[model samples]
Target: MSLRQTYRLWAPMYDVFLKPATRSARAKNLAQLGRLDGLNLAVIGIGSGLDLDWLRLHARPAQCIGLDITRAMLNKAQIRRRDCPFPLHLIEGDAMQTPLASGQFDYVVLHLILAVVPNPAAVLAEASRLLRPGGQILIFDKFLHPQQKAPLRRFISPLLGLLATRTDVEFEPLLAAHSELTCVRDEPLLARGWFRGITLQKHPINQHPINHHKD
Candidate 1:
């Protein structure tokens, strides 16, 4: 099924569906963003804004923009809205093709989104493009680690992979493979049996100096 169709089915139960199964899996990813005060933060495929509380408590970002392809998801987020609107922007767009300009953000965060996209590399490239020099990006999603424990990951992971954006895709090496971005942190919040969470820094794409995004 297409991501939109899958999301159409999931938009209602997404938080509940993810929470029970991926609770331990998603916590640290949420926790990692708390320190990003005053930064321009853009979150792609931000489902229900369930993680907003954690992000706000931690990062205190100067602005927050949430983007998702499904309007239902964005509408749901509006109902769950936290008290402060502090520079909040909502855009209906695809991660692989955003309406925003290049190098237009200080940080980008994706929570369990890549695996389900039709093109994970395209989304990653977008992540690379939207980020300003020295900008940081955080990704929390499934990875089919060849080096992992077999018996455990064997059962649950394939299902996650099946449900993930790019079925059976591996994002672990892709994050490390790129020279433009540096791996600042890698943590396994789940059973560490299968999936992994990653935080990476966007090194300057070129010799250009930092030209941060305009509001």
Candidate 2:
């Protein structure tokens, strides 16, 4: 089954299984935004709009856009949008390559998405592309440390990836590919460090000092 089909079936019970386990971590990850007044934010792979309530409580962004591939998931998010005070727009679209304009957002959230997508690097690159320079990306998902031997996880990653999420993804290599993004904070959140909360900031333009020489 395609990932979208898998998630379409999973959407009905997604919150039932995920909400309890991820509630605290989600709040903690969103907290990193630290009062987002007048900032434009995008939540890529915003499954079931679980983050909306937290955003409503913690931030008053100028606008927040959520994109997801599954219509069933977007339907759930639509229901949750009614209570959100900030402007919330939900789009049924792919995370790897969104239709949104480039460098228009102040922040991007990628909770529980990296491991779920087929090309995590592409999604990360897309998120980076969507952000304005100096904007930050907040990620909360599971990752494996380089050279860590987890035979079972590596073995089952292929099968699990088809149905849900990948277990063998390494964060370092993905981050390394995007030189413009700098890791600011990374900490373990759940499952004995299997799941992590990471924050990345896109480097601003013209960082080098300009030399002023009079001829």
Candidate 3:
């Protein structure tokens, strides 16, 4: 079965297996999103809407949007949304190419998706495209530090990918490739040193040179 299919089967048991990590990441990331009362936020790989509770604590559900590719996962998220204290926009869509308008969100959340998604660069690009200039992206996932080397793990990464996640995604290069994105914060979130909470900000549009048309 494909990775999406595997995740579809795991959807029912997803929260049970990931609750601890999810809770910790949520608290850490949410702490960085201070005073979210009026900001529009989008959770790119919203999964089963597990972060809804944390988001609601900081902002109203109306200010939040959730997106994911899998319908099964979205179905579970719908259940979660129904139980939420307020309503939120939940759309079944791909992170690399979501239906959300450009510069629509003041903040974009990318929790545990870098390794799960096939093209991390494309995903980041889309997130950047969706975010308003100067907006921040809160990313929580397992990734190798730019300077670290893991030859053995890299060799087995393909086998690991069979289970639905890549084992060795390096964050620095991805951030470096995007001139508009700057890594403002990076810290280890899980004790094993495998997972991290990173915050990146997209530079304002005017930061780049503009081409003017002759009047």
Candidate 4:
């Protein structure tokens, strides 16, 4: 089944299963935003608007945009919109390539999304694209460390990926490809370091140092 269809099927029970496990991690990651008084934020792959629940408890932002591929998931998110202090806009779209303009957001949240997509690098690139210089991307997901031997995870990743999310993705390579993005914080959140909370900042235009190689 396609990822959209799979998630559409899971949408009805998504919160029941995910909320308990993710609540504390979500709050901790969102806390990294520091103050949300007037920032423009995008929550990519915002399934069921669980993060919105957390935002409702805090200072309001100027606006928050949420994009997800599954219509059912977006529908559930709509119910959470009623209580948001900030303007919350939900769009049915792909995370890999969104319609939103580049450099328009002050913050981008990628909660439980990187490993779920077919091309995580593309999603990360898109998140980076959406951020203004000095904007930050907050990521919370499970990732495998480079050269770490996890045979079972690698073996089942394909099947699990088809069902919901991939289990074999590595975070380093994704971040490495985007020279403009710099990792400011990375810490283990759950599952004995399998899941991580990472924060990345976009460097100002022409400010990231370039490498020089002698030939």
Please give, for residues 20-77, the per-residue lDDT of candidate 2 as tens digits: 8899998887788845666789999998999997887667888999999999999999
Q: List the lowest-lDDT window of 10 residues for candidate 2.
A: 206-215
Best candidate per lDDT, number? 4
Question: Whose lDDT is higher: candidate 1's or candidate 3's?
Answer: 3
Order by lDDT, highest first: 4, 2, 3, 1
Model 1 worst lDDT run, 10 consecutive residues: 206-215
For candidate 4, lDDT tens digit of each residue in 1-215?
89999999999999999999999998888888756666789999999999998898874778899999999999999999998978999999999999999988888999999999999999999999999888889999999999999999999999999999999999999999999888989999989989999999899735532221211
Model 4: which residue pairs collide? Answer: none
lDDT of each: 0.71, 0.90, 0.79, 0.91
Q: Any residue pairs clashing in model 1, and if so which?
A: 34-58, 34-59, 115-164, 115-165, 115-166, 116-164, 116-165, 117-165
* lDDT by residue (tens digit), candidate 3, 109-157: 9998888877899999999999888788899888987777888767877
How accurate locally is residue 125 in candidate 2, as Cα lDDT from 0 to 100?
Answer: 97
